[model samples]
Target chain A: MEENKKTCLHDKHVALGALMSPFGGFDMPIQYEGIIEEHNAVRNACGIFDVSHMGEVFISGPQADAYVNYIFTNDILSVEPGQCLYGMMLHEHGGTVDDLLVYKRNSNDYLLVINASNIDKDVAWIMKNAEGYDVVIDHRSDELGEIAVQGPLAEEIVQKVLGLSLSHLSFYTFGEFTIYGDKPAIISRTGYTGEDGFEIYTDHESTRRLWDELLAAGAKPCGLGCRDTLRFEVGLPLYGDELDDDITPVESGLSMFVKVDKPEFIGREAIIKQKEEGPKKKVVGLEILDRAIARHGAEVLDADDNVIGTVTTGYRGISVDKSIAMALIDARFAARDTQLKVRVRRKVFPAVVIAKKFYKKSYKK
Target chain B: MSKIYYAETHEYIRVEGNEGYVGITDYAQKALGNVVYVDMPEVGDEFEAGDDFGAIESVKAASDLICPASGEVVEVNDALVDNPRLINEDAMKNWIIKISISDEAELDDLMDLEAYEKYLESNPH
Candidate 1:
């Protein structure tokens, strides 16, 4: 078995008496204080997350724009420099390789931030597809660390504590700033949670120092546990769960990010065909009527007890106080207010298909 | 006076004559973080020794509750239904169910407080 990788903040999490667990091949803190406490903190106040395990790859060359457009589903030509667009890299068969963030530094330069677990797979896929293109791909995940400060107070705390004025940075936009005489770093006004926030990328040393200052400045130390809950409450999809080797973004209700009209690109044909005919399966929200929680891999059954689909993600809902889940089922049965049943362990729970966004977001537009 | 006995699975039963109150031990509650919900069996439900009864769910995972002795449940703890965190606050005091013991011989199979403490030390989460 491969040894689990540690983030630069691993020691700091241990010092804070956090409950550590393995996630995406990294030893990450699952919770600090408690899951409910940390989760509520992010919803009400500010919370800091060590997201250094995320992978970063820089692509630059004359053919960078053409190459990225060919491999990515989103239309990068729509965005100018200092902008970020969320999309997915797909297989020729339309299955997702990985969902990622593409930062448009310029027409000829782009930064692709990917999931930690798919770093190796994503790099290999990108390289193999770059045979004819003249782009230079540099995987710089090891050299950078990332921290996300998320909540309603994130903008205020980041500007006051980090001393970086972000009034000019709009949503999904980023800029370079040098901190403490260090190299220029990237800070973006984007996050997975349904709250206003900032994601900072810098050297490992600077990352640790910034974490210390945030904690001292009263930002609650959050872990991956609350991160998942916060994101789920907002209906954001996690890679392995919502989209996988067998599931396309179109089926996951993420067609907004896939530019099917693009003249030429990987998976364009399959995605367009699915879009025209409507995907056979689709992602939907479920509210369990019973107290039992429906979790991932739980089976979805129709009235006759025939399995119709499987749950992608589920929770007891810390903020909403209800048993809710996101499930991928036959498109015909994915309508709102549809009745369904989720087989959770020993019992079958009655559920109703509802809006996936269980909690409304409060982003600062 | 009630005599306390613990099962190897971390459930405890406090016996006073033929009636007993059953709950998870402190060690079990501590191991399973914040308790979000407890699935309790209905009153008048009968179980054999070592039978699966209900379940306890924490934020992370769910665990099945096992009956340590045979009995018919006389009362269920309704308080835990709305506030499962009571188990976390005090596991011993917040018993899950009250039952009239059918087989007193099963008590001989359980460990005393001293032996249960030793068992907890040997097995740590």
Candidate 2:
């Protein structure tokens, strides 16, 4: 078995007595103080996350814009420089390769931020499809470290602690700046949590220094445990849970990100076909009536106890104060207010279909 | 005072006559972090030794509660139904279920408090 990789701040996490666990090939922190405490910190105040495991790839050259649009589901042509668009790279059969953020630096230069687990697969897929296009693909998964400072006070904390002015940057936008005298850094007004936040990418040394400074400034050090809960509550689809090689963006309830109207793109035909024919399964929200948490892989059943779907993610929501889950169920049972059941072990808890967003997103729009 | 015994899986049984109060150990609760829910068996449920009677869910994952002795559940911890954090506060006090031990011989197989502490020392988490 291959040994798990460690980030630059792995020692810091250990020093703080964090619960370390393996995630996406990296030995990452699962929680610092506790999951509930860290989760509440992110929702009520600022929390810092070590997101360096995320992959970064730079696509440049004249064909970068068109090439990105071809591989990605979203229309990159619509976004201007310094703006980032969230979309997925899809297989020809409409299954998701990975959901990612495309930062359009210029007409010919773009940066693609992909999930940590899909780094190798995404880079290989991009290279294989780069056959005729004149695009330079720079895979920088290891060269940089990233951190997300999230919550309502993120803007103030970033400005006060990091010395970065984010008042001008709107949501889903990025700006390049120099840190520690000539070290290039990218700060983006984007995050997975529903709150307003910024993701800062810089060299490993600078990242370590920045992490120390942010911690000193009282930004809570969060881990992947709360990250999952926060994102799930906001209805953000995790790569493995809400999407996979077999699940399409349309079926994941992410059709808004997949621009099928675009004349050409990988999996466009399949996506359009699925859109026309209607999806067989759909990702929806379930509010379990009981406190018993219906976890991932738990069976979702119809009234008659027939298995109809599987839970992708579920939690006893800290902010929402209820048992909620996101499940991929048959499209026939996807409507809101539809009664269902989730078999959480020996017992089946009553559930009702609701809008996927269990918590209102507090983005600084 | 009841005599306490522990299973390798971290469950503890406090024996008082033929009845044993079953709950997870303090180490188990500390390891599990915050307790969000407790899936308890209904009263009168019978279980063989080592059978999973219920589950204790934290914020991140769930762990099954294994029975340390053959028994029939006489009473379930109704307090855990609404607030599972009672275990986290004091695992020894917040018993998950009170069971009538069907086979007292099974108690010989469990570790005493001293032996359980030694076991924890030898097997560090």
Candidate 3:
């Protein structure tokens, strides 16, 4: 395999004795102290993540809403001026182009946060989709960087560092603010970990300075390992794991976000068709009975030795002390009480399909 | 008191009479990060040299516990089911499994403390 590209924080991570690995085209830190400890830290205290590798694209124009709503699967028009919408851009054939968070700055301007690996493809896809529409799309993925401060106490660290109270911010809301008067950036109360946190979008050139600033302000720097466990515990859908081009949003149990009532979106017809005809499969969560973990490609088998599904993602689930996983399988097998077998290499571990929300949120809803 | 011997697979073995206490090395535990689960061997199982006796599942990956020396499983660490960190806290002191060694000569092939550290130098995570 080829050597992975390094992020701006590569030197900082190496100096901190972080274990580095290639993730989404960037050489990133996998862990610092450990995965579970950092996970628990984010749960109980606060942790800062170097999420600069995530792509940030800016789309501006008077017809931004019309263009956004036409291509995105969600009702992007519902997003308030200072709020962000977690949505998906769809391929014409109903597959997902990319799962994104479209932050509306105003009626005319919007920022689309997309996955790092999908940035180039997303830009090309978005451009191709907007060929006839009257809109200007900018793939500022290289010009911008992002970081997330997550957990229960993240609000305090943000306020302390930037001298601003995030108390006024609601979930999925954002505002452009200046940090120490160097450059203005977007700070949003949103995160992947299902915790009370914020994702800051700033200039790519100024990110390293701000990262050091946040750490100096007493935010514990966390790594990717903890991010996986934190997101897994809450049953958040991670791209390439819970989501991919091979799986439709409806099949991944994200049908709730797909508004069939919305007229003429890219994948609307397919989503409506699926709703009317019923999908072949549905995603379900599994809680293992033993110590064995269900990995991304592990087979979810039945008692009869037939493979029913494949485990999408899994983790230790530090708080629960057992393995928990999500799997997209035959819709007929999507029952809360249904038992399944996960083959972990040679051993077969017993598992059961459970309702979503592996860990309940205590957020200010 | 048992004398501790180390395996080339990074497992530690403590010899008490003909019985051998088995667990992973400290280096392996540190590399594994926070251990979430310890899959143990069945108490009645007998294993050959280099056979995977059990596994330790961390948050990222599930790793096998290769048998350093072959033996019948006399005991398995049930405490590690919940407290797998014991392997990290004290690897040699807290044995994961105890086995009756088939041959004492096979133990010589295993690396000792000084040689094991030397082996770790070539292979880095």
Top-DockQ candidate index? 2
Q: What DockQ was computed for model 3?
A: 0.68
> Interface RMSD of every candidate?
1.4, 0.5, 1.5
Chain A alone, TM-score per model: 0.99, 0.99, 0.96
| Model 3, span B1-125: residue lDDT tens | 77777876789888889999899888888888667778888898999989999888778888899998889998998888778877778766777899999998898888878888988997776
Clashing pairs in 2: none
C-alpha RMSD values across all candidates:
1.9, 0.8, 2.3
Q: Kindly indicate the candidate among 1 and 2 with the higher TM-score.
A: 2
Write one digit per residue (lDDT tens) for candidate 1, span A230-315: 99999999999999988999999999999987888899998988888999999999999977877889999998889999999888
Model 3: CA > 4 A from native: B1-5, B16-19, B44-46, B103-105
lDDT of 3 at A229: 79
Ranking by TM-score: 2, 1, 3
Whole-model lDDT, candidate 1? Answer: 0.92
Decide which is better by lDDT, 1 or 3.
1
| TM-score of candidate 2 against the unseen true structure | 0.99
In angstroms, the error of model 1 at A347 is 1.7
